[model samples]
Target: MAASLAAPAPAKGAWLETWLAAAPAASGELALVQQRGREALRQQPIPSSRNEDWRFTDLALLQTLPLTAASPAPAALPEVASGALRLNWNGSSDPLVDQALPAGLQQLSADEIAQGLGHTLAAAGCEQHWPVELNHAAAEHVLALRVTSRSQVSLELVSAAGAGLQALRLLLLLEEKAELDLSQLIEAQGSGLHSLVIEAHLARGARLSHGLVALGQADAALLAHVAMEQEPESEAQLSSVMSGWGLARLEPRAVQVDGAAHTTLRGLQVVDGQRIADTHSFVEFKGPEGQLDQLHKAVAAGQGRSVFNGAVRVPRAAQRTNAAQLSRNLLLSDRARIDTKPELEIVADDVKCAHGATVSSLQTDELFYLQSRGIDADQAAALLQRAFCEEVLRELPAAARSWCSLERLLEAAV
Candidate 1:
């Protein structure tokens, strides 16, 4: 039996107990938002080095530091602009940061809050290690968002430093036949971990176009979990470009629960400078007549490491489900490395699911050809690298363009 608490210990022993304990609890549907997370943490502790899922990553990096409680700082008008999305952080106090978002997207009901639960190892599978363990434990740094209408909301989410172990809960609900085009930016200061749990609820005939790009301090780690449920005739065209320093992980997970919902996922991962980056994506078809398409790209150079995992599962009830996943990797140097895994689990009798992976080095012939021309070997390699990434870059929407100035990003990365 679970031990009872006068209230409840702070979440996951995240080391943010005092900070979260000082925040106010939710009064709406997500009434016990903070309490439930704490309870869940109390029941199942986050995995450490013993867990396989996190074996490649370090969990103790979070427990070692004595981080001062995270507080929201005032943000001025963003210097950059893309797709009409302008971001301004007017938050002074951490408590008031919860209310700082545009009032157009606040829906903190109990059911909605409950839906945000279960991202933990205890919620998914006991054996796996969750990346957002500490963030979930803090629970106080959550932001719930609801997108209605054809929302052309351009967003730039900045993860400023000094705010260690924070969770940004984004709840987006697209109304019937509504549309949402969003762009996300994650930049952190100091060496701290930041996680964002994005819960998207798409109504019948709704559509969502989303993109995310992140960068952090060398010792920091970050994760983003996107959960989406698309109704009949709804569509989600999603793409991402992740370029960062340090140990970073990106996971895009979604389930189609009804009708003809479609999802398109395209991703790019670049690692160098002894940095390690991983991108994991999963799309599940739980309803009838839905389709999903996924493509991933990874490039590892120097002594850097990279990993890509793309999975698609179709349940028996999901008749006429069509799914496809592909992963491609490029190793620029002999020391550079990449681990690519593509998986498909389909129980549906009538469905189409396929997966493929490829790893190779830069073509010497191409290099020779470029050198044969006016281009030198180094320039040729950079050009080829640029071309190799062009496909993924072109797949991104306006949201991605703002987050990752790809051309500028690659100049330094390559």
Candidate 2:
């Protein structure tokens, strides 16, 4: 870890100042992003800790990451996830990496990146926000791409940053009838810091399927922001299966401006030993005729910590919209902890919205049923556990393969 990435001077009530003080001086877009951070010092930094959304995994760990805008030496990519497509960047410049993107997929220009980031960040209502200023200040190299309707594309992006932080800026456009299987895995042999900013746009009558997963050392900071915008009559299914062997932070936000758009979001994670994983998601239905469904699950063992904070907001204009969200946790050890919160806000009357969250131990009846078969207690528990998580993976494009492989993975985890 760079001394700069370590803690900076303790400047009371000045998060941005402290951050900038520790950041390396630079020029151009990256510099502007830094200046934006300097400006954020005025506002009270969103207090994230044991009392806030970060009640589970304390964000004090984030301070350990070097906030510099330094370039990372090119990192290698992983071919498959732990079992399937682990570290699967596949050398992609875009989220859906390909030697030649399909006809409908194209990178967005600087002007387009500017338009998308500004439009989405406007929701936070944080005047002079660091994220917005940083986005405007820095225009990362490479063009963000889009995959339009009815398009069937399977792509991967894998990278290994030997040391320090490397940034990837992706702009994804998914049009109607477009389908995408996007898988990304980031890892490094040494300490590697990674920053990813992705903006996705789904057009009318289009459908999108996306997945993100990562595994790496705990000494580095991984800040990922995903902004998704949807048009009318569009459908999206997004899944995240993250492995937290090290420290990990993921913030994925999705917004729907027009009505008739539906989306299902789910996240699955397994944590053991002394690891920390955090996920924050916000879904906004700004128009009428929208529907959003969210399901989050986690299994924690040993001294590990896992968190899931999800929110669904239906503005007044969102009449006839239906939204349901749930967060579930399976704790495997007494010392381990799982924090979960599911929120729902509906300003429009006559709209159907429900939210619930629960954490509990395995059912004895289910364990008994498995034991009654010719299986031992351990095998019985693994069998029941696999069945519990199957629903989340049921929507996978390659469900059959995932089923078999996941069964084996469960057996190994047990």
What is each predicted model's overall lDDT from 0 to 1?
Answer: 0.65, 0.63
Question: Candidate 1 residues 1-414, lDDT tens each?
Answer: 346636675455555454445545534333454465555555566655476444455444555443444444443223645444344321222333434544244446556646644433232232122444434444453444566665445455554545555556665667777767676666655566666666677788888888776655556666667667777888887777766556777778777776479888888878777777777777877788998888898888888788887777777889898888899899987898888888888888988778899999999899999999999887898888888888877766554564565464553343
- The TM-scores, one per candidate, come to 0.80, 0.78
- Model 2 whole-model lDDT (C-alpha atoms): 0.63
User: Which pairs of residues collide in candidate 1?
Assistant: 29-109, 29-110, 30-109, 30-110, 85-154, 143-169, 145-171
Give lDDT tens digits, candidate 2, residues 94-177: 333444454665666667755664455454232243333333333344345666557666655555555544566566777777
Instruction: Please identify model 1 stretches exceeding 4 Å from their true place.
Output: 1-31, 48-52, 63-66, 70-85, 89-129, 149-153, 407-414
Locate the minimum summed-lDDT window of 10 residues in model 2: 83-92
Best by TM-score, which number? 1
Model 1, poorest ten-residue lDDT window? 120-129
The local lDDT score (0 to 100) that residue 99 gets in candidate 1 is 41
